[model samples]
Target chain A: MIKKRFILNFPPDSGDKPFSYHLVKDYDIRINILKAEVYPGKRGSLLLELQGKKDNIEKGVEYLNKQNIICESLDKRIHFKEEKCIDCGNCTAVCFAGSLTMNRDSWKLEFDKEKCVVCELCIPACPLHLFEIDFR
Target chain B: MQKTKTYEEINLKLKSGKAVILTAEEVAKMALECSPEDILEKVDVVTTATFGAMCSSGAIINFGHASPPIRMEKIRLNGVPCYEGLAAVDSYIGATACDPDNPSYGGAHVIQDLLEGKDVLLEAWGKGTDCYPRKHIRTKINISTINEFTLFNPRNAYQNYNVAVNSTKKMIHTYMGTLLPNLRNATYSTSGELSPLLNDPGFRTIGLGTRIFLGGTQGFVVWPGTQFNTSKPKNEYGIPVSNSATIAVMGNLKEMSPEYLQAAYYDKYGVSLFVGIGIPIPILDVEMARRVSVNNSQIETSVLDYGTEGTPKLGQVTYSELQSGTIKIGGQKIRTAPVSSLSKARKIAGELKKWLQNGDFEITKPVQMFPKNTSLKSLKETEADND
Candidate 1:
């Protein structure tokens, strides 16, 4: 009845095979492996639903840890500042979900939170230090 | 060196459940003509390093059409040459016939050999590998974000994700197998007979604990792709493609440590390695059960009956109740219902977790049910009513 969740942040270019298969076999835990969905030109997200007993789940965690699948906590504070934004469309160009769009009249920017899976792709796209990740 | 029988003979033996060991050359030749099933039936164990290829996502079933039969290649296990083509089949046989003297190689080769057939053992194993290898790659410096853009290339995407997963699995398996046993033998506290000491539940608990710690530390490698790209060469097969970024979510490890796991392992094995060893491998065979479950659940037609007035009401009831996260199962109020395909899948996942923790560890009837018939029946009934 006990349930726990952890996010595993991968470096750019890592595959899902070794982690997925090992989770199933080594820890004896079945995971709902969500397909890695990539926004048009942004980083992707791989969602996994893992469930087991308190101890087994812990064992599964240990197993993942030993394999180097570290837990990731998102910092929502990292965001783009409005005034410093250039509205050059660079962030929009790299945005996979069109989460950032250009305003019609002025060269201004707009942000959509619903479309974001928190991949943090647009943070660095802005040339100016307009974005920051809020770890809290 | 002696005059050997034709590849056909070896293929025949593989198909008939007869165990025959062959060298690498013989396996390659036989693989050209043998079916995956043929290879599986005849080989109990296969050892080869070429296994990396078979486990890859790009691997295909040649069936004699492409260069050679992909299933016929041999895979190595613990420095021994083994056939991977028959891995799934052999795993089933091995699980059923495995003795304490020979623990299921966690059905590693068999799971790969049987392809989907390996699911038979996997479902029974209750998820996860018995052993996992851990590694640490110190980076030159911590680079938060490596690239500014994402690559739309499918090949790069697939490679990136696949390699990460594969590397993680390999590391876990290696560490569990290599380090735990050595650690236990070296740190054992008993002063009695060494052979009997090996069977003590206390020792096994310690071993499982060590494996858990190793597994927990192993999780660190799943994240921080920027380090991997900058530190490792782009041409390396192990590295993920440069263009893709991975968002890895790791599970909490507070409960999965060695001390807790020691208790679980002890509960299952008792204090005697001999008794644990005596436990029947076949009936507890994870591979065979997974196969039977998947095969029986393959797509099929079905029919359902509902009274003329009750049909629509049934749909409304299911929809409403399922949305509310409750169901009337055999008059008892169940907390969840399988209203949609996705929900059904989620439900099954829940049940699988339950089975792992509470059900007998030995292979038993599948606790989850495939929705093939239920969906088909409902669809047909709805169509008839519409017509």
Candidate 2:
């Protein structure tokens, strides 16, 4: 099974459409909506995770595109500023997804974006305030 | 006869580039394979290090005299207020003192910025007097322009600290870290076996005037720290089970590096300074070897409930369990995290070892040894009944 994350930006008019219901129904893909901000007549965005066969996941993105929703991959959604970070593993306490962790061998802080679900837990968890959201 | 060494002997070897040094972690690992006597003979010094938030820290700066020589009564560095009761141009900028407009930027940030060679806006006000006429002055200053930049910390490198956890339904922000609700995770802030005081639990080697690695440069232990409580109960390994002894250190802030000094900001808490400190313990005897060899599994600390008002103790866990990433509290598995940087602690220990191996740093016999019994007295609103 393959997993993918994306931030779906819905146009102002299509905010009422049920993107999760349609993606799961038509594309046979599993959806985990990490974050959502949908309101009728207002442009909204969603930070979500999709899982299933690779083809089904791609079809889900296509389905989102067909509905006037601009789907963007969430590869570098969070920035880990290494220079500012003291490598204090405080962020890992709130990051339940195991994305922020200490490399046991090197004892340094390591961020695995693949494991991060964009929970934004590390933003406030960092004492240095080094983590930032990069939607652009 | 028992094999022993002294500060002079260690310094002689250090100066000749023949001193055998190992990090506290390395010596701890070596103790598992070799006997204490063998290890003591081979290793002359064991460097212990820690890099963590130390709030009772500040810098003393003498901003030279003004044009007309004002007895400055008030001072602010980059808009952050500093203590102004000292000499005319001398003042102390505490780490936690924040800017009125921005809480994140503080005196610690100002210190690090100055060390980075960046200019800081200095503003001062003085009461017009006969001896000192000038009233007000504002100017840009850097490290080179200042007279003395000394990092004098009231407390740093805690011997041990409590593990913080939240027991309430809502999340809490503390100096320890952000704690999730219902005791979901635990946060600790120490380097375990690689800590300075832990290796020298008896205060035999670390004392006033002892040379140390402070902010990437050599410094000295000035006095026993503010809450220097050496009277705390010890565990089976002779190490304190809770926050115990502490040391007051000072160094030339101008000679320090930004890598070893940093400013920290907590979510709801305030500003603090992350200080890098390392102390090398000379292997004086076989007993000293045994103390330096204590490992994480043997070092224990209490988990306290931060959700409550008094911070009641919940349970005890070892650093090995905390470093394992998960610990059990009352049969429930709770995730464990650290506020201290073990990697940076290791780097400091390695750096101190390099200083010794290269003959750049030498051991100093403490001018005075700390007293063994120190009561951590509590303050009261009213006087105690003596009757």
Candidate 3:
């Protein structure tokens, strides 16, 4: 269950290539498109979530690289200051993705990074000065 | 009138033995285990609490006159204008007041800066008169240097509030925080069943001079809150669905902590303070205990259309429904979120409960019961002189 977010860049002159189709048929990988702004003979950008075996995921990335597509991993990251978080469950509401949630048993906030879209909705939702977003 | 226990008897029970105390969150389970009469007889006190986005919250400071004694008129703390309507050195920095120079860092942040023990730039101007010499002053002042500091809030607790959402196609920012267009999200602010006023719906035990837990320290209720409206629709529980009675509270600023008091900012919604408050309700009788046992499913609030100027009710919902993480509106199950923090409120209630059991806290007798027949009046309907 190797999963990662990617920012794929397509050059304006990169010929008509079914970039996503090739990855699935050739490398046996799964691609979930988060966002895309691409067209024929136009520079394209795609935000994608890829899931597959570790070696197959690597092979898929190499395939995209040879196609003149810059496949950069988008580590859209957020950190919770454990001491500051009140665990009031405000984040769980604004978060469209279930990445941020409350553990019903402990009532403690459980943040699943795998499901986060980096929407930054939790930043303002928190009453306490917790949930800091750092994107590099 | 219904039978009720006096505040003295409960205090005696607390002092003589381990008082059967329960946090606001624990009341539901406690009720299921024992009858209301049985629980009421044994339970000395039920602690109610809330931590929410209270925009009208802030502190009043009286800075003893500086050398030459300038009669300060206009005042700004960290570029945020504070109300200097009181005599010379007195002013109030409200939570919603924004910084004139820098829009982002507002009065709420200034209050936070002071709580963090940081020196804030104090700038003021005045016209020198016969009694006062200096005209203007600019200096750094921290919480310690101030002569008197009081957290005087006109409306500390709102009995019930609306859950906000934007139904319009365009996004809108409001004091309720950013409301996404087309009902992408809904944000509600209230401690629900754990709120002090909710536990005592009819204002039975809450009134003037009632000792409370303010920012982890003991404080008092000064008077009925501004916009205290007793005239509103109520349910079987006697809890008003509309914005009902409010309370005016005062606490020592120096004795407060940053943990309970904080500054907050919404992307485009503006600044406000997170004030932690807890009030203890003595189970005077079975009736009082029944009131404290009010559940979230029984208490209700409205989801409002924030895209409009004045609040308009779009739908009616309960705290249980809101806390369930989803709410249905316009044939869609939209995600529901709370602007208030129940976790923080529970913490405050638990802390007060400990203070009560340890004999560190004392419950004060209400000087007077809150008014019941008052109607909310507008400013235009009043005059300073006796009409």
The fnat of each candidate, in order, is 0.00, 0.88, 0.48
At residue B187, give the lDDT of candidate 2: 96
lDDT leader: 2
TM-score each candidate.
0.16, 0.95, 0.88
After superposing candidate 2, which stretches have Cα over 4 Å from the reference? Answer: A18-28, A52-67, A134-136, B383-387
| Model 1 Cα lDDT, one tens digit per residue, A75-118 | 23335676544233435534545556544323246776434444
Residue-by-residue lDDT tens digits, candidate 3, B83-140: 9788889999888898655666788788878878999999999898788888999999
Best by TM-score: 2
Query: What's the C-alpha lDDT at position B194 in model 3?
Result: 89
**Shift of residue A52 alpha carbon in model 1, Å:** 11
Instruction: Tell me the fnat of candidate 2.
Output: 0.88
Which portions of model 3 miss their true places by more than 4 Å? Answer: A7-26, A36-46, A58-76, A79-83, A88-91, A102-108, A123-136, B1-4, B378-387
Task: Sort the candidates on DockQ, descending order.
Answer: 2, 3, 1
User: Which candidate model has the greater lDDT, 1 or 3?
Assistant: 3
Reference contacts reproduced by model 1: 0.00
Pick by TM-score: 1 or 2, better one: 2
TM-score order, best first, reads: 2, 3, 1
The residue-level lDDT of candidate 1 at A96 comes to: 49
